[model samples]
Target: MKREMEDVVIVGAGIAGLATAVALKRVGVRALVLERSQGIRTTGAALTLFPNAWLALDALGVSHKLTRSYDPLVKGSVTNINTGDVQQVLFSEQAIRPVHRKALLEALAEELPTDTIRFSSKLAAIESQEQGGGASIAVVHLEDGTAIKSKVLIGCDGVHSVVARWLGLAEPVHSGRSAVRSLAVFPQGHRLKHEIQMFVDQQGKRAAFIPLNDREFYWFLTCKEENMTGEPEQIQREVLEKYAEFPSIYLDVVRHADLSTISWAPLMYRHPWRIIFGNLNKGNITVAGDAMHPMTPELG
Candidate 1:
């Protein structure tokens, strides 16, 4: 018996991988998106798709729709926690749409073709070759002893991409800081202004809040990179204890949140165009998104 070949095999079904699938399919090419995770699960806090990111999605032909504005009571301001001096402020009032991470992923997935994504296809290595007919060929090996051959290979496996490793790219560099993020509901009566607020300390710690929907606000606290191995209860208590002296509005959001919904990660980044594999003359293998250049999640 003989096996079949695919046009392109994508590693990672994240925002970048899924988006690429849509783009390739629209151009009449078949794409297979492989995800290491067992399912399409999104962890971490909510996100604000700023104007730039929205434009990118729009160019991809997907619209960014929000059920409702998150921060109607927002009073935009950035303050220095140590000196109490204002660094930036927008006195003018306006609503900024915020969306849940799950909602955003679902929406993006909806735009892609079905049967193109395969979960649990953790990549192990890639081999390149020249072909006599049609597009050049590259082979991908998965951790579970499954091997897929494709005419083209794209690595969208994120910052810790195995494709990058197979290409001998260096590991992502730590940015010296870590971020703790979450989304919590602040009761209707406790609705905050629609302005984003940020507090930065001289010790390299920071906290921020942005309302995504009427009832809930997205909040985050960043501190020096440290190990997080404590129980959820302990993690929750430590988060609250860190900002015990914050204003009532801050506490109110935390009051409605538990450690289960909290998320944290150390910031990291990778160089652009770190490595290029596959048939360069034929353009069979390529990389995209964080696999190409991983960076901190700042404004977006």
Candidate 2:
């Protein structure tokens, strides 16, 4: 196979990969992002960006674009479904914004030069060679029978990262839980408060809803892995049936959910201890984002 050379080769074009590439570009370094998918992968509905995340985006010089689009959440309320007890908490001066996953990906991707992201490029294997000065070069082999060499190779390929495994990192363990998420749209107007509302039942099930904008909001339900199954429509019905006792407001949001955006998956994360003592980097190869430390979304 022919060989291509790049200064930096980043695997995966998700949030971390794209953001890392944009950050490098800002500092006069060019990188090539390889994504296995055909295009940008907008799998999840939205993500909550805490103060630190915004600072990172700001450093990347793309926070303003997002700040203008997403409103900061000032407070939130958590309610116990069985006890009917509610706890209200106020946020600090630092802002916490919930943004559409797709928007975030696009914002970072826009900052890079055209053709910076190469879709349909899957990493099949990784190798490295020693060089002068005791440094090393990374060789990334793609599934398409092409090989690329780079001075530095960063893996942002997510929980199932091939590079992470190559570094001998343990696989992400299942949290014994699954979640169903979707974006609910109210074209007329949701007219809901710009705060987060969460509900938890005694059965270890938890759910939360957060407004993304005036007309759209994000919501998710966490339950035992065995509790959810089948197609999107079936899952939608299951949500309604399983949480029939939840507040009418939550059900209303479910009713308005855009089925096309509904997604279901088991939650997985790396053990904290493993991350604290694992081989995060070897030679010119390293891992970042979910590849390094994937955690349950609820912890976010």
Candidate 3:
């Protein structure tokens, strides 16, 4: 079969892949992004972008677009359910905003050229070939029976990245904990302060509420990994039951959560030592983002 040729090929169109493509485009380097899904995967309800993250976004030229929509949170309070003690924490002068995943994806994708992202393109296997003169090329094969040759192959594919595995990276190990996240929509406006609120029990199970906007907010709960399977409704109920002693506001958030936004999964991470000593790249192939270093989400 005839093989197509390109300068750079990026696998996975998640936050990392899209951002890398935009960064390359700014430097006059065009990259083709391959996504296994049909469209942008906006499964994670939202993310808290710190000052450093915003600086990177600013470098990419998309921070203003997001800043206009989401306001920065400057303070938060953590409550201990076991002791009924609340502690207040203040943030520095830098901006900290929590944005919806969909909006963030769209913002980064907007900076790309037309057809820059190829959806429904799943990476099957990869091989490196010598092109003489001590040069090499990466041959990427897709599940659909198409082959593409590129000067550089970057894997931004998430935790289960095939490229990382091809490079002999160890599999991600479970972190002995599970998390459930979702967005709660308040149609008439939530009327809540623009601050983060968290509650923790004696068992170290924690729940947090973060306001995304006046009409919607993002919330998540982390606990010991148990039988957290089944439908969104079931998961929502589980959260309610598990944290029944939490503040009523938390319960309300879970009760009014958008079912489609609910996501439950066991946290996984690649050992840091392995990443420090393992083969992250070979020839012109390399990995980035979660494909390179995946860790449990503990930023709070």
Q: How high is the CA lDDT of each candidate model? A: 0.71, 0.93, 0.92
Ranking by lDDT: 2, 3, 1
lDDT of 3 by residue, 182-292 (tens): 999999999989899999988979899999999898999888886778899999988888788899988998898999999998888998899999999998999999999
Model 1 C-alpha lDDT per residue in residues 194-287, reported as the tens digit of each score: 6677877787777877777567777887778865547756656676787676555666676676456687778787644443432212257777
What does the lDDT read for residue 158 in candidate 2?
A: 97
* Candidate number with greatest TM-score: 3
TM-score of each: 0.85, 0.96, 0.97
The residue pairs that clash in candidate 2, if any, are: none
**Model 2 poorest ten-residue lDDT run:** 223-232
Cα displacement (angstroms), candidate 3, residue 137, comes to 0.7
Task: Give the candidate order by descending TM-score.
Answer: 3, 2, 1
Worst 10 residues of 1 by lDDT: 273-282
Model 2 whole-model lDDT (C-alpha atoms):
0.93
Could you tell me the lDDT of residue 166 within candidate 3? Answer: 95
For model 3 the TM-score comes to 0.97
Every model: Cα RMSD to truth: 3.5, 1.4, 1.2
Highest lDDT: give the candidate number.
2
Query: Tens-digit lDDT track for model 2 on 91-148?
Result: 9755899999999999999999988999999999999988888999999999999999
